[model samples]
Target: MRRIPVRSLAVLATVGTLVLTGCGTETGDPADSTPAVAGADRTIRAHEVMQLTKVHEETGMTLLEGPTFDGTGKLLVVDVTAPAGKPKVIRVDVRKRTSQAVHTDARGAYTSAQFSPYDGRLYLTDYAHGEVVSLAPDGSDPRTFFSGDVDGARMNPDDIAFDEEGNLYVSDSRGLSTGDAHGRVVRIERDGKESTVLAEGLASTNGVSFDADYEGLWISELTQNRISYLRLDGKGGVASKHTAVRVDGGIAQTDSIAVDAAGNIYQALHGRAAMVVYDRHGERLATIEVPARAKGLESATNVAITPGGTRAYMTVSGPAGGFLYTFDALAKGVRQSNGG
Candidate 1:
């Protein structure tokens, strides 16, 4: 299929600069397009859906790719500085809709955050420093956990995830203009042993996650407008990999993703100011619309779900600075719920 182009394509790399550029010129065109669903031994429904409500304009914290919540229900977000400024991490109280700057350093820009399954510590990546650091929630001295230059890959560490076995996965996205075969996913073990390259030739793989069954891995391809799945056979690595879902009229720039308890996958389709949900079979279940009140969410980078599964938290970048929004998902047994 032709490359899906929505709202995410132009923002991932230029987010810091473009978010301040205003929600670009409106095209005045309809927002309907067909998406591609790819995978092994599976075929799924492919298309885009419309929103039933206006975009929620409420603001929380300024972050690039976050809203990651902890066991305590506290959501941590990314603050990519104030328009070409510095970077920091902010904590958002979901219950009160209030936020506080947990760690704001004018000298560093932290791109992504992941909580270690085995230790519960926070693992953060610095795009500019080419380093990954870990800090306790108590805000102690941040220590270098992993550091490597992405020079040969033409990429940087963006988002991260953890498998059921406590393994760490990092998404290495190629530069703005690059294509698949450039993005990389690296796996880090508990002993700090690292093995790189799970799948190669992905069109900007930025976010990744495994299904509830832990049988398959899902990755967000920013430049390809599709989610790829890799099946796990034994453990050493993925047995095979293939495209799982493609968003029609969707931007190739997909950033972050999360999978619910039922095998449903949630992906942030950046640039287009939208979130897409896909079933286990790779069908597009629903597309959550984001109102572009500011920079049109240059790169809607990360996604988080409350432990209760009642809402999904998203981070978007714009001229008004980075903002976060919560999407109310209907409770499972609540009849008459639209799953909105």
Candidate 2:
């Protein structure tokens, strides 16, 4: 097979250097002016949960993103750049710090893995194929559960979230390369038949998750370097939205995020080895640095906090390869933390 260039998020590298002058007019409730990680809890030296073997060809870099836990207490992650014939999904034995291949397909560059609360099947975003597919519990029966044009155009589906009633919300991460660039959010009903545009005109929508109370959704915009809260109406469309918190990301870009039971957001950062914590109202709490000092561990793209929110498992990768690091959670983990 011919080589297909990887790095579905290659835009991150070019746009990461863009200075975060501001996050629009929503700076009234600003993050603290203190150092990003000042006086923050430096997690204990992390135990290497596992390492990925597959490496992409073009950049010679490997990445592990979309870390979420299965209902049976195992952590599931995606190999964002895994090429054809290689495992695209992995299951981690956090207790033993070992990993096993769960699924592989030649048609997709899987960016996110989320389980539907109503169906119990693992749903993943195929970044390359522009489709949201589902898998059986044992990694069988891969099928295109949702696909086709979103908002009159194709989408580069990035992160995913499932609501209490089994609705799927997706972030389309393409079209952010120019001044007119915008990201989109699409919602699919529980039956996977009807899809509606939830929100649009975003700046590189990356991480997406529901709030603790299910009142709204939290979206991480990479180019703008901020997180936005999409307040949902009774019909699940976006009611009102506001920038929750502006990330003081000097040279880094924001990625996926998880919301705890306390309504705090744990946002992952690309090009930096840290996760920033913020309250529901956009108050900056702390920035937790990556627990390891390895050369390539400086970038953590996604985090999965256990059900209790007592622990967090982050997916880290650079030239040194893909690694998983664990840290303590600032708030109790809730259903929103995992698989979303």
Pairs that collide in candidate 2 are 308-333, 309-333
Tens-digit lDDT string for candidate 2 (197-253):
888889878899999899999998888889998999978788898888899888788
Candidate 2: segments with Cα more than 4 A from true spot: 1-47, 57-59, 177-179
Query: Which one wins on TM-score?
Result: 2
Backbone clashes for every candidate come to 19, 2
Name the runs in model 1 displaced over 4 angstroms.
Answer: 1-63, 81-87, 149-155, 175-180, 250-252, 291-299, 330-340
lDDT of each: 0.56, 0.74
TM-score of each: 0.74, 0.86
